[model samples]
Target: MENAAWYVLPNEADIETPSLIFYVDRIKENIRLLINMIDDKSRLRPHVKTHKCIEVTQLLLHAGIKKFKCATIAEAEMLGLSGADDVLLAYQPVGANILRFIKLIKQFPNTNFSCLVDDFKVAAQLAEQASAEDCIIQIYIDLNVGMNRTGVLVNEATALFKQLSKLKNLSMIGLHAYDGHIHDSEMRVRKEKSKPIIEILKNLSKELEEIGGRKLNIVAGGTPTFPIYAKETDFDCSPGTFVLWDKGYQDAYSEQPFLPAALVISRVISQPAKELICLDLGYKAVASEKPLLNRVFFLNAPELHVESQSEEHLVLSDTKSHSYKIGTVLYGLPYHICPTVALYEKAVILDADGNIQYWDIIARKRKITI
Candidate 1:
């Protein structure tokens, strides 16, 4: 995914169907545009769950990005191996995961690792393990701005922070306020809904700084509210999908400068009916979270209507009466590119010189070498 001085594409004949094609130029452009938007690389702590490749992480590092946010320990491990200096495991670790997380930190001593905690009981467990390992683990208090997911409520954050401060071997570094609820397509509506939550953080940061006696880093927002969060200098923005813009986000947020860097290239395999053709792009290749229409945007055959989709086949009805011969190549922009990328083991990365190479999905698997 990293752009080298010499880049190009591979022979079309060598590529198999249902393969992910990653554009090197577009990836680099996205990185540059994000940095330019932030006006400083230090303000951005991009999530790595989108593209799990080490090359992509290295690309971000090359762009002067040091901090990274990930959802899993596997992703954190990949980041550590990629020489990422600082990484935040955004999800709260529970059960045996607490010990696994501590082990990860020990393995990558050079990488400053942190995880989220909404409950003091989980924080207590983490503190115990960190104490056992004789290591101090950094933690971010997960604050629920609007999303009723994993974070502690805004009103309860300060109390939990105070409780976490008392836990042994656990450092309350900052607050993780993820407002995934404010995903209005319109920027004005998105901003309006996110304003109160932003204020909550502003107030919370002031309270924490005064009481904690230090500047507390607030990592907030996702792809939709990235622009709004970017304006706040004190908050560190963690937007994942901005790296490889997908049809879903690109259509919703047209103002974002990111290009469709990731795509699923399928081929017409069978002419089942007069105007109906079967494609190799199935639910296995694409993310089925969205509806059929929003699942993928057919680049070549925009007029094609999706008839049905199964594990390995996607039937489409071409209304234009245009006939595509069997084996004809077609490209599709997945609506949800994150899970779509996860479906594939490796990507057929195309360079500027028309040469194709493969990049392994290093963090795609569930477990690391723990």
Candidate 2:
């Protein structure tokens, strides 16, 4: 299997050609690794916010993952419309959006939709909306483990759960605790810090069982915390970037061998000096989180350095004065995979033969209110 190449001259007289290509097989391998990491009963509700593409979502679904965790109602609707039966609007939907929530419930009757709530007021609003529509809406209590982001504290969760249990149309299905602080770098330290929170959840589940007389339906874990938390905690995991590994994750797991499937393909548009070779991809195409690493070494150019980036150009430097002519195609490993993919309008997929299999970017737009 070889990559497709297009020829282009540095001057206007020379015809332009394909510079770089993205391989889909690498993405499949990454997904397979994540699948192998979890148990069969453990629900892999991958977050759709990472790669909001229908093709990627469909690929995951085809790989035996039915449930998905979405960050916005727009992503939920997109996933639901894409024939995904189980979609969880994982964001905290509060204030003045009851009508929109009602409309979504009405629109996707066959889909099993759920949302997160941390406060009593929002829970009441959700219950009210569900009652008005005569719908049974499943709800998850967002617990603030240690991230201190949007969830309610561990002490306050019991009261919220109790209040939610009495609601007519709302069903307290489970607990949603996202330990975003646990990445690959500090997995051990983060896991240690998470122990107390996991204990709290375990105890809370027990208390909820006694109060409601039933087991929690959905105890969820978010991000790369799945591996550590899933083993110690009893909950379904929702890790998004695992499907498309990034440079950050790869660096986090430096001891392990992980392949970054997603890369920004760029062409050398300028060779301003002997040392600096500029590419056609920059901050607009790749995410700016963490730091961009040199992936050209995999393409047989280890001496290259990704020095800096502009809006649409990347500056590559070779300190050793290695000859790099203009029109060179380079692949860049993104620091953060989620936002990087969101920046692109379409992703060109390549097969082993380097032939263009297809282009998919159906879910690239912002979320819809309805």
Candidate 3:
């Protein structure tokens, strides 16, 4: 069979309104496509914060994905408890999370857990906690390639790496440079912009290596610049949205060879006027991060204009004369799938053989069993 322009799930009638539906076959295909793109399984350390479900994590683990990156300590704890081999807390842990991070390391001794540290004081604090528990934790030096969100500047990387090297209980493993800012619509433009950032990371890594007297592993890039970084064999590519592709990235980067694997299944709740209708897809159901016009793309109703949205309802104006029944089901592709997945407690998984299953968003919360 050729590539499907559109994907349809089984048992559409049985699916309830305002439900998160995941195409299992499509998700598997997405994973396969990403692996093929990189051509090396070890290079793909996908982020689990996109799905936050143990079932999805197991699928990746079964597919030989031994390493993963997560944002929250809860996500890291889940991966550790699930027996993940290498789990990286991509975000720098601070405050109480530093203690929680230490607890996770002690809780699962078999699982190798590491974290990102951009600040020297934070790294020192983590070392103090780990030393108190008599545990050693690995940490990557987060470099600011461009995002400027949560990483050390390239010039400041050496000083911080030196400070981290002095810590007794903390091992400075590598560098993590996230280029989330280089998201150009044109593939060529995006790759061209990524070149300088990747060069900065390489230069910083070389400097840190010269000072620390060892080779440093580098992790870089998100979904937008994943294809660009795939060319750099030295960098471990962490692209999360590739697992469940969304319209936002797909539309922006048309050359990306992935399909939308997650969609919001909603039903028409009422018809207030001839051209106006309200859907059960409220802000609570889908992510409302983007502008109102680009919140979601209707798979069935292409001309559906989102007029307004409340907590429990999305008012839309159907420009076309096609009439939809009150219970007519509609599939919506969310612009941002990461936050959208978090809004739901569980997802309705549609498998290849038309089988239906429920997968709980286990790591959606901020806390995990200490």
Runs off by more than 4 Å, candidate 3: 1-7, 351-355
lDDT of 2: 0.70
- lDDT per residue, candidate 1, 1-370, as tens digits? 2462122233656789989978878899999999888766798999999999899999999989999999998999999999999999999999999998999999999999999999989899998889889999999999888789889988898898888878889988898988888888999998898888888888998998898898888899999999988875558999999889898898889878898888888899999888899999999999998887789888867888998999999999977768698998788889999999899899888655667778989899887686
Best candidate (score: lDDT) = 1
Q: After superposition, how far is residue 98 of candidate 1 from its true place, in Å?
A: 0.7
Give the alpha carbon lDDT tens digit for every residue of 86-185 in model 2: 8888877777566666678789888888888998888888888778778888888888887788899988888888888888898877888887866547
Q: What value of lDDT does candidate 1 attain over all alpha carbons?
A: 0.88
Segments in model 2 whose C-alpha atoms lie over 4 Å from true places: 1-22, 184-186, 254-258, 291-302, 351-354
Please give the TM-score that candidate 1 achieves against the real structure. 0.96
Candidate lDDT scores, in order, read: 0.88, 0.70, 0.87
Model 3 root mean square deviation, Cα atoms: 2.1
As a whole number from 0 to 100, the lDDT of residue 331 in candidate 3 is 89
Backbone steric clashes in candidate 1, count = 12
Worst 10 residues of 3 by lDDT: 1-10
State every prediction's TM-score relative to the real structure: 0.96, 0.87, 0.96
